[model samples]
Target: MRHVLAAATLAVSATACVSTATPDTEPKGVVVDPISWGPCTDIVRPDGEPPARQEPGVRCGKLTVPLDYDNPDLGTIDLALIKIAATDQSRRLGSLVFNFGGPGGSGVDTLAQAAKMFDTLRTRYDLVSFDPRGVDRSSGVRCGSNADMDAYVELNTLPPTQKTREAGRAANQRFAELCKRDASRLLPYIGTGNTARDMDRLRAALGDAKLNYLGMSYGTQLGAVYATKYPNKVGRVVLDAPLDPSVTFRQRTLAQTRGFQQAYESFLKDCVKEGCELGDTVKAADANVMRLMYKLVDKPLRVGNRRLTQGLASTGLAAALYSEGAWPFLETALAQADKGRGDALIYLADSYTGRSKDGTYTTQMSSFPAITCVDSAERPDEGELTRTWKEAIKISPLFGSEGAGGICTSWPVAGNNEARKVNAKGSAPILVVGGKGDPATPYQWAPSLTRQLGNATLLTYEGQGHGSYSSGNKCIQSMVNSFLLKGKVPNQDVACAAA
Candidate 1:
């Protein structure tokens, strides 16, 4: 659901009836059922990853939502959910829902892994997260086999030539065919609007009068769509690393290209100050990185039994740019790559792609394409894609041309691009968190979304990362906590100094 840094990163099967309702609209007579919680079982994990920790007081449940809300009788799908109830029940406000981005990110798994981070907030609210429709354990979409995905990620889409463009399209078409073959029934309904509707359903299931949410990265997009559809239901909402709903697919992609370029430059400057081995100056370090990427295009790097292609290298680099703390690792990865070892870079790439040591891939990769293709409406023509790629290369030669039209170019289903202008008039106050150096969702989009949601306030974190609250900056956390906990909306936009 983001700028496709590489075809590999642009990465589910479901059974249900075709959706006949207008996309993202809740039809009359909709019903919400209470979730039946029990011991956490059936939690999906990467092939080699261990099972979810059995945290005390944690419960797991499934919410059954209509596969086609427009035509409820069509069928139903069960959404996987997890919850850590408030420690101080007497002081509890309600359940606080979270969407950890990825459009396809498995909230069930993420919440369980990162629950410790929310301990303070959990004292007054049950921290809840779910694998939204078309995500893991929720009728997640699956495409080709692990081996097929291995080939898919390594497909080179760079240099924006006729040959490379055609190859990219062919690979996308093949991957799309696999998804259609595996998940045709559910593909048409896997957009943000439906997921937002699922969130409303979730809110009702949790017995909340208003929806309280924390959404980061692409999660911010999902939150915005929800506010657009159910403005009055909006409670205390915090959208960190906000995505601008107003931008078209191409515009978002181009902006991300520039964002990543800026983040990379920032990283290089830090590396130089630290006396990094890559170069003595930022410009030289950048050129060396470009040279490595170009070299990998023709000669793959060997990491044990796996080969690292240029596309995977780019994915690894982009993944690192998501957080400033990862810059040191990126520097180390680059240094090792310069020494002809690709293991470290491959590790970063695998982390982003969710590839396990045993070679099985997570459903997130499959669902990413399913969700993004339907959420984004820009179906650019060949010429348009070529032009965008050219512009991207000019913005960041190392990262710009990794993706052209992304998997959407060959998607089997059309996108609805719901609520492009999300004017959540009269909605409850929202806190929009923007990290000045965020590479994935740029800082500029925060003000854009805050302005659109008239009742929202902008909280700027002068930091470098994809998210703000999770950055552990006390100033940011305090402000966000105050808003989520006590409904303390800042009278004016506030900027937190970087720590």
Candidate 2:
């Protein structure tokens, strides 16, 4: 789900924890059983096709888990799972698990989309994606009011001074208070550690020896945690846009600030080389754009009747920072904002916020803060907060000060888990993928995580974007497919360019 930037960053480190008890010893109340097949009402096939008739061997089932792992007797949650039983019955590989990027991303939704892209792998091994605890269609954590979420998004996450910091702190307190009032019971259980345990339960019910996983962004960190806790059960793991599990939330946000700065520079250079309409020189283009951001900060512009303020401008800029494919659109929005036009930029900002034209919001960001607040352990002391904000502004005048600084200050609770060195020892060989120009999860993070995971191989995509597999890069797709299917690792660091 889309939390404010801080929540999204912290969610990367929140995967389920492994039970300390040995595999032979089941916890007293944890139940594991295979669910019967039924018609999947939620399955949405591309182009209105009927659910692909279950290939002769595929199995669809649900795995039930406890709402709280610490107190298994409290209540049970149903996790939906789908398995494409191996066609090579003679040499069946184990279950290949997946989580689509969001700590809020739907694994079931991902499978529905992946059905076409990964038909080959589907036939060879069972591909499974369960709704992690606290997600749509699974036992979910709700915050009763969208007002709480709106307040969070509207908070000045870009606190620059003591006054702004105080404001952000107040906002955080208010949001936390709302959560405690409405969703107190669900708070502790939505973290990543429990999600990883849920995966293990799914594995046990499915009777798999190890988890073969492909995860991206936040999902990559989830896979990493699973490998760390259950190394012996790791098989052909791939972590794309990997998160460095050892960095604190502030550190990660700062790193992301730098990453976006780097990506912006890359975009400027390319636009200049291409003689794009935005500008002729990278320096000129950057100065003009940054000027627009500052101007908006002081006085919002009007597009017909709607007012586009600094917050909306910052949101638009953050959305643009997500992928290089969005550069031209960003340029156009920037140009329009420069001429006192704000509708285009406002619409882009709305899209990033998951706000529709009709003024309704999807639940993507609703549970984001709840999960993030509990996952991270780091809290920025006043001094550290001041210094980080100053540094961010110096590096990225438009995004650093505004987008990086605000969310964590008022986090309702201190995070339970802090980013720390992750040495996934004894884990199976894991593949790490990095995009050269990914704004949110930088390429540098891939190498950092690869070095930390004892058995990881780095694969580089010399392209721009957040993800590689479906990002229109053949080399990336080939490399990942080969690794997932044949269990072969890249010979050395591999590089992929846009095809």
What's the TM-score of each model vs. the native?
0.92, 0.82
For the record, the alpha-carbon RMSD of candidate 1 to the native fold, in angstroms, is: 5.2
Among all candidates shown, the one with the greatest TM-score: 1
Over the full model, what C-alpha lDDT does candidate 1 score relative to the true structure?
0.80
Per-residue lDDT of model 2, residues 27-82, tens digit only = 56545776676656665332223355544554556788888766767887787766
Go through the candidates in order and give the clash count of each: 6, 15
Error of 2 at 348 (Å): 3.4
Model 1 weakest lDDT span, ten residues long: 7-16
lDDT of 1 at 151: 96
Please report the candidate that would top lDDT against the real structure: 1
